[model samples]
Structure formats: structure tokens, C-alpha cells
Target: MQDPRMEDELVIASSPTDDGISCWDLHTGAEHLRYKLCSSPPHGLASVAGRFLASSQLRNPKSSASGTILYWSWNKPQPEVKSFPAEAIKPLVSNSQGTYLAGGGVSGDIYFWEVATGKLLKKWHAHYRAITCLVFNDDQSLLISGAEDGCVRVWSLFLIFDEVRRAEAKHLFEYSFNEHSLRVTDVKTGYGGCNAIIVSASEDRTCKVWSLSRGNLLKNIVFPSIIDAISLDPGEHVFYAGGRDGKIYIAGLSAPGASNSSYGNHIIGSMSEHSKAITCLASSADGFLLVSGSEDGMIRVWDTRTRNITRIFRHTKGPINNVLVIRQLQNTSPRTSNHTLASPLRRHGAPLPSPLEKFVNSADENAYVKVFINPHTTSNQHLDSSYITVQTMENQIKELQQQGSSAAAEVDVERLKSEQQRSLQMIQQWKTMYDNLHQFCVDELLDPSHPGISSGQPM
Candidate 1:
């Protein structure tokens, strides 16, 4: 036996009740660190390049200055930096290079900040409801945001930076997916950059895959219960969806359609041992283990090969909101910090190795600098070259416009416009009604014949 919990010696889990983080060695089931938190972070904690840890804390929900982001160095016991964003942000994600940090707010907005200075770089309205999850691609070129509005949108960092620098009025989103009918709980991007597939879990009891390159819906998988979280396989071949029914369903991405349904196509495997609903899930860096956190405050580590529970760690008597498996750094010495200065490397359309290969051999023991793959993989069927052309975009639009779908889309836009007008009219009518009621009350009060009160002054 290979000791089924995979390589989870550096795994960390956080509970809502404790306001503390617990790190454990999954193999031995021993505790490593029990760091106290100032406040409960919204979507758990994140580590930055093995140097420091970042958490978005919610001190008081009603206060204007309730939300604060705290940064702690690896060696220091206390937080090194504390910055109040003044918004109740729930989810936070950092880029691979550790230059930029993105947070999702309860007000359905996304805020981008520079790590070193803690400066607010950009803020935008992302969804109608609260944002639940945020994730960056391998190269940090794209940012995927999911919200309770059941919308998943992809944004280009390069384009965002350029637009901000130029102060352009027009905003551009790379892609927007509205396949989910309820709130989107989790969103994870697969290996490839532009050609990557985004798997989003929703409260609608479904998980959908959207193609980043083609900007289209590729697949929709229905689960028995609401899927709260999802983790992609290292090979990008399969994904694990944790549901409220206390089951982890293994859905396929590269599996054939016909064989997947009959010969266990998309739904390949499942693990159901938890007595409560699963709240969060995280896969090991090597893809050998799947860790799931449930409502019963139990964290179970499953062996992917054997499809069995290999280890279980009991957390606090609260829901486990976030679980992260950070790869331990080989050397303790810190690398030079870039802070908030973002110097993005230009994409030259170079192909990188697969995520599995990159994850296995990412750390460099001898070299001072760490090894990281950008994951700029592209498909031959849709993308023959690395660089996208104007003609290619036009062709894609034309292809999508086929079968009179463009007219249908136009109709949808018009319907939305009409709906907005109707809503405005309703508001105006309500305002008129309120004004009439106020005048009637004033008249009644000013009249001496009214029995409630006598007129004290001129109305």
C-alpha cells in the first residue's frame, strides 16, 4: 500500500467557529501549527509563495470598517501587514507570482489590490449577488470569478491593467457563463491557459464546463445534490465535485461521451462516507489524494487510486469553509519580494508542459529561484497558433451566429432592456404613491379639525 492519503503533509484547514487555522500532517495525522486569527476570514486562508500567509477577515458584518486583510510572514508569529478594505469580502485569491491579490465582496463586487503596498488597484461590479469564489489560472493571466448570481466570468489581467492605465471607459470581459440557475459556489480552471476548461459547481445541482478559448459551454453535469465545491485533477482529465448529500462524485472531462454514460463515462467514481454535507474539497498537488470538508466538522482524506477514505481529521464544531494543500518549500530562506509592483511577462505564445509534469517537478532543490510552469497550452482543433487574430475572432463570432442564434441573442438583449424600463416605471409609480401619502398625512396634520394633534406651527 502507498499510504492512501497521498502527499498531504502540508495541508491546512480552517473552521468558522475557532477563528484559528490548523495545519496537520495527513500521513501521521499529527498537528503542526495552531495559529490564532484576529477575525474569521471569509473563504479561509492563502499562502503567498511560501513566504507569507494572507487572510481576509470579517470582524463585524454591520460596521463599515468590518473587513480587513492580514498578512503574516512565515517566520513571524503575528501579522506583518493589516489593511482594511472597508468591505465585507468573502473570497480572496493571490496570483502565482504573488504580485496581485483579488478579493470578492458580499456586495457583489471584485477588488484587486497590489500585494506589497496594499493599494486598491481596481474595483468593479461583477454580479448581482455576493461573490462566492475566485481563482487564478496557472500563469495568473486570467482571473475567474464566481458569484451567487449564478454567473461565472473570466477576466484578462493584461487587458484590465491596460484599460486602467489608459483610463478607458469601456470595460471588457473575456467570457461570461450563465448556465447555472442558482448561486455558483465554486469555480476551478483546468491546466491550459486560454484553452482551459472552467468547471463551476452550483446550488442548482449541476456542474458546468465552459471552454475558455472558444467561449462556449462544453458540458453540463447534473449531480444528485447541490455541489458546493470542486477540485480539478492534476491531469485535467477528471474533477471531483463535493455535494451537500455527503458524496464526492468523480466527473470526467476528457472521457468519451458515449462510453462515459454507459461504461461510466462522466460519472466515473464516487466516495460517500460523510454523515453530513460536504462543504469544501481540495486535491493534492500530485493528484493522488482528494481532501473533503463537511458540515459535521470532519475532514476526510481520500485516496484517488483506491477510492477510499485513508485519513480523517476532526476540526472544530463548525463548518469547514476552506481547505488548502500548500506544497512545502524546500528551503526556508525567503526569495526577493516583488511586493505590489506587477511586471507581467508578455505571452509569446510558447507552449508549456502539462500541469501534472509541472506540479511533480516544480520545486528546484539546487537552484535559488523556484521553478514554475505558465501552462499556456492550446488546442489544435480551435487554435492552430498561439496568437489570436482579428480574423479569428470574427470567424468565431460568425460561426456562433449561425442558425439565427444572433437574432435570438438580440431579442434577449431587447427583453432585458424592456425589463429594466418596466422596473424603472414601477419604482417611479411607488415614489408617486409615497409622495401622495406624505402629502395626505401633512394635510391631515395641518388641519385643525384633525383629532391626532393640534397645529403647533405653519405647515
Candidate 2:
């Protein structure tokens, strides 16, 4: 099996089914592989470098078959590695180098493991409720966690391994934020390492940006609905917040009115197209595309310049819990073109009308009538010579009849006969009107009571 790098692919995961993980080519949007797992992932999906993928299953309510981590390679369907941590994990993350894996459990404890050996590196209690989100800093040195208890904590990996510092502090967290009054839904860190800004979204209907350098709340922006996910802008100037209101709000990290934005209080703008609550968000490295997943099972790719959807990928019939956009591997190319083998899309029932039908429906009915009435017109000349030619129409009717579409051929013949009759009637009416005018002129020329003839005595 050829190992693929995680950066070169777009990864997606869904729930309530055995076939869940799907990988697609980032450039071409062609699906490379689909893996069927032992169970649906609840804590979300992670790619271990480019060699394999990882998913965490929720513990089954009726059976003891879940709470397992499943790993799959690019070319295989079954998991290469499966481990049961004995606790149901909800949020999973990988280090920048993919050397280690970390998961947050329902018991509010975090577990770290070496990806190669599957050996447990560290496990500790971090929160009072299930962990909702986990993110690593740019260098993977700091792990940020959010929980249902509304506490956002930052833990340092260096300190986690220090035996001397471990004894000095009662807890290992570098900073603990308790501003949120509801469950924290998502958390993201900005560009800088230690000086980076951390933002947390919550069920409290607000997103807060905390300064890791100063250990203080930098900004708090409230929304109209509960915010579920957030993605930072490329420049780290503004962050996009997705909420239950089906809108993505752009909140500035700087102070209110400090930037060139006209909107005060850092409420810059919003992009609303999703009909359901957004569940997750991932931005491209260049920030040209912002991908968002919703409870409606739609993944929309937005152009940052226009703030409009550029492409849409429909996932399975379940709420999309995770979305990831990474760089395409430099060494790997797309396996297929989008025109050949496209990604699997969940299409709605009943296909749409063809383009020809759509164009006819959008146009005024009288315009088509005018074209048939005046076949010699410049606009209809091309169409008449090509599609409406007598030979062409006859050949098409014959083909339809040969294909057992006698009803369709009959309808076409009737339409053509009616059009020809209407054209002949219009021409006949125009000739009749012309003849009547000519006869009236002749009668007036001979009439003596006509003003010009009667007054022509001087001539």
C-alpha cells in the first residue's frame, strides 16, 4: 500500500454507519478511498501523517463493543490498529508531526499515546465533564482543551513530562479560563506559539479570545445563537464563528473599532447560507477557501474573497462532526480527474430538470411564439438551419421512434404541425390586410368626393 500524507488530502468523517471515513484529492475533489470502520466515530477523525487515519467510536449503550480507536491505512478497509482505552472519548487530535495522538474522554480525562508503538505516554484528569474540543498549538508543544464544564485549559507538553515541575505545581495546566457559563463547543489557537491567542466557542452564545501571553481575556463577542465552531483567518486578524443561527460571523481579535472596519464592537460581517446549525469548520492554509459542515450533512466550500459557496459536498445522512483541509502532498498527484471519478455525493430524491427545460422555463412564452411566427428572423435563422431543419427534425423523430419513444415523437410532430399552421395563418392575415389597404387606396383615387381630386379643377 502506498502511504499518503495527511496534508495532501481532504478528510471527512460521519456517524451511524460502518463506512464512514472518506478521503478525497484536495485539488481535484476526487475520492481516493473510503474505509469502513468497526463503528462510527463520535470524537471525530484524525490522519496519522499520510500513512493512516484514526477514528474514535462512542461507547455502545446496549453492548460493550465500542470506545475503541480504529486506525486505517490509505489502501485498506479494516483498521490496522484498534485499541480500547476503557473510557469513551469525545475529542481527538494529532500532533503537527503525527508522532503522537491525544484524546479527551467522557470522564473529563485526557490520554496521550505514541502513534508508532500505540504505547500510552500520559493520562490525566483535566475537566469535570466530557471534553468537547482539543487543539494543539502551531508547534504541537501546547495542547488546548475545552469541556462541557465551560472551562478552557492550556496544557504544556514540556511541563507534562517534567518530573521536577510536576511536583512544584498541583495542576499541570498553564492557564485555565472559566468565563464561559455553558459547555464549550470548540476551541482554536492563532498563529503564534506561546504568544498565540486562543478562542473558544460555547453553548453560551458567545466566543471569547484569550491571550496566552498575558493570561487574560482579550475579547468577548456575543452572538445571537450558540456558536459551535470557529476558524481563524490567514492573517489572524479576524476569526470566523459558526453558530446555530446558520450564520458564520466574522469577529475581530483587536479592540472594537481599532481596525479599519466600519462596524463597531468588532462585529465585522457575516456569511449565511446554511439552513441548519454549522457543526465544524476548517480553513485552507492560504485562507482562500473556508470549509464548513452543518447538521444538514452539507459541506460548503466558501471563497473568502466573495464569501459565497464555491462548491458543496453532501455527506451521509448524519450531522457532519469534523472537516479538515490540508496541503496536498508535494510528491503525490490526484489519482483521477473530477470529470472521471468524482467524490461520492449524497444526492436528493428526484433529479432536477435538464438545462434545456430550465432555459425554456425561465424565458417568456411569447418570445418562443415570436420566433416560430417569424422563422426568417436573424435570431431564429441559426436555430432553424441547425436544430429545426426539416431533415434534422425528421431524423430526430425517426430516432425517437426507433428507441421506443413513439409517444415523444408523436408530441414533437404535433408541435411542428401546429407551428407551421400558425406561421401560415400569420402570413395569410398580413397579405389580406395589405390587399384590403390597396383596394381602399384605389377607391379613394377614383372617388370624386375625395378632397384632393375635387380640388384639382385648377390642374
Candidate 2 deviant stretches above 4 angstroms: 1-11, 16-19, 38-43, 61-65, 255-264, 332-459
Tens-digit lDDT track of model 2 for 118-156: 545567889998888888887567889999899999998
- Enumerate residue pairs that collide in model 2: 4-50, 5-50, 6-50, 7-327, 8-328, 8-329, 43-90
- Compute each candidate's TM-score over C-alphas: 0.68, 0.68
- Model-by-model lDDT, in order? 0.70, 0.70
Provide the lowest-lDDT 10-residue window in model 2. Answer: 350-359
Q: How accurate locally is residue 192 in candidate 1, as Cα lDDT from 0 to 100?
A: 66
RMSD for each model, in Å, please? 22.6, 28.7
Candidate 1, residues 1-459, lDDT tens digits: the string is 325334324567776565566676655666654566635543647765434567777777676357776766443446656666647778888776555578888888888765543445567787888888999887678889998899999988766656454366354577889888998889999876778789998899888999998999998888778899899999988899988888888888877664444324477768889988888898877888889988787889999999988888877566787788875432222222322111111122222111111111122531222112233432222222323333344456566678667765775678699879879998999999999999998888777876555544444
